[model samples]
Target: MGVIMEMNFNEDDKYLLAKKKVEKIKGFYGNLTSFILVNIILIFINLYTSPNHLWFYWPLMWWGFGVVIHGLKVFEVFPSFGKDWEEKKIKELMEKEKNNKNKWQ
Candidate 1:
């Protein structure tokens, strides 16, 4: 089995956490830009090449869904679920497991 490394986070780690969020937002914007450009080109091509069928909406709908999810993840809407939430959940589960082990013993 591979060794598992435990994460030890400190208050100073907030900066690193913020940096990661910034990176995520940056990536989301890049993806959004690409989505717009590619979809626009696809729309034009679909309009000119196969105007009867109009197949561009297929990729547009799917890719637009992805962009919306990416936006939610980057902006942390609805269910944010940040680092603090993760740490709290970890501690809660660890305590619960410890208690269960003690009860069994």
Candidate 2:
């Protein structure tokens, strides 16, 4: 037979978790805003300085990829690193700690 355990979060834990989530969202927005503003300036510079040979697309494409990944991670759009994965990892760590404590006792 296997023993089952349940984890519960108190009010403080809930509040902290919510705060962390909000911070991640804010950070993502900040990153996205920077990406847009910087790319706009790059586009302008490329056009004004060297319109004949364009090169702004290079940074735009690479930075856009990073922004997309940041957004996906913040929004939990990727299943591998989403909420389920976090919870599972937390539980696994807690179980490991419990076993170690038991062995010492």
Candidate 3:
């Protein structure tokens, strides 16, 4: 036989979780917009100022790496630290705390 567990959450809790997810998506979009706009400006400046030197790519590449990681995290593409990991960690910690309290009592 297999064991099944149900997790119940109230309406407010569901709403708050949904709102937090939306906020994360919104933040990712904001980061992407800033990355595009700033990189555009940097490219223009590099082209106009140095032309042959081409140093704009330095910041673009590094900042782009950060943006990519941020997108991956926000979209939950990386499972290591995603929703399941968070819930599991939370439960684990709660269980540990309960055990400690019981030991003390």
Candidate 4:
């Protein structure tokens, strides 16, 4: 059996919190860069190998489909994490942390 405990956060509660936020941003930036890189590589390969007049069109079609998927993630259409929501959440978290530290000290 595992023991669970809840601890209080103090003014020095900076390490984990800061690390988590940095990790989150790192993850998003990594995903965005990787996504763009992969699509660009695919587009370049298709463009270079295209032999027919409409061969370049094939990559465009495939890229269009990828764009739709990326758009959904960016806009958060279904997961409900649109731009405003994300911004508000970040602001709220910062305020909450500030409040907590003030109260603790």
Candidate 5:
């Protein structure tokens, strides 16, 4: 009936959304697991060669910040700029293009 994509969520869509959320959380867990595993290996490697210089901590801290943010996003601890924002932006662009087209014609 309408040309524009529907912005509403039906009951079926909720299941898809929940599945996507679970996937995100599962991905974060995988990321965290890799982080821990690799860091443990690096820690031993660092100690084996140069016990004084601890370079592994450098990546540990920086990448750990990224992991934290990823977790926050997955858990929705931080609000996302979501579908509403995307839809509004799309509408704005379409209006701009329409106005430009009108001018050309």
Candidate 6:
């Protein structure tokens, strides 16, 4: 009885952890998509305006930095909320789940 009860508790914990990680990845990807769209619109608007008004180009350089950051996040080269961190969390959750299954058996 004691062993079975412990196994159930562990499995529940693993499920909850996995759920949280999935939610986090969803939110991160949503943000990333939105950021890309906004960057595109801003660039188009800037290029459409007059050539004498050179104020927007400076912000474009900053925008390029943001693009680089987002690219890194997308590629999983950096620890992003969607990619690296989520992968690590999922691995940990799976290991926990596997251990719980072993205990049940």
lDDT of candidate 2 over 1-105, digit per residue (tens): 123356688999989989999999999999999999999999999999999999999999999999999999989998789977888777788888888888899
Cα misplacement distance, residue 99 of candidate 5 (Å): 11
- TM-score (all chains, Cα) for each model: 0.74, 0.87, 0.92, 0.40, 0.69, 0.45
Clashes of 6: 0
lDDT of each: 0.83, 0.89, 0.89, 0.62, 0.80, 0.64
Off by over 4 Å in 4: 1-8, 12-14, 51-105
lDDT of 3 by residue, 12-79 (tens): 98999999999999999999999999999999999999999999999999999999999999999988
lDDT by residue (tens digit), candidate 1, 1-105: 122236677878968888988999999999999999999999999999989999999999999999999898778784538555676677777777777788889
Comparing 2 and 3 by TM-score, which wins?
Answer: 3
Best by TM-score: 3
Candidate 3, residue 64: how far the Cα is off, in Å: 0.3
In TM-score terms, candidate 5 sits at: 0.69
- Model 2: weakest 10-residue lDDT segment is 1-10
Candidate 1 wrong stretches, greater than 4 Å: 1-11, 80-84, 97-105
Q: For model 4, what is the C-alpha lDDT against the true structure?
A: 0.62
Whose TM-score is higher: candidate 1's or candidate 4's?
1
Name the better of 2 and 6 by lDDT: 2
Looking at model 1, report the run of 10 residues with the lowest lDDT sum.
Answer: 1-10
Deviation from native of the Cα of residue 2 in model 6, angstroms: 26
Cα deviation at 36, candidate 6, in Å, is 0.8
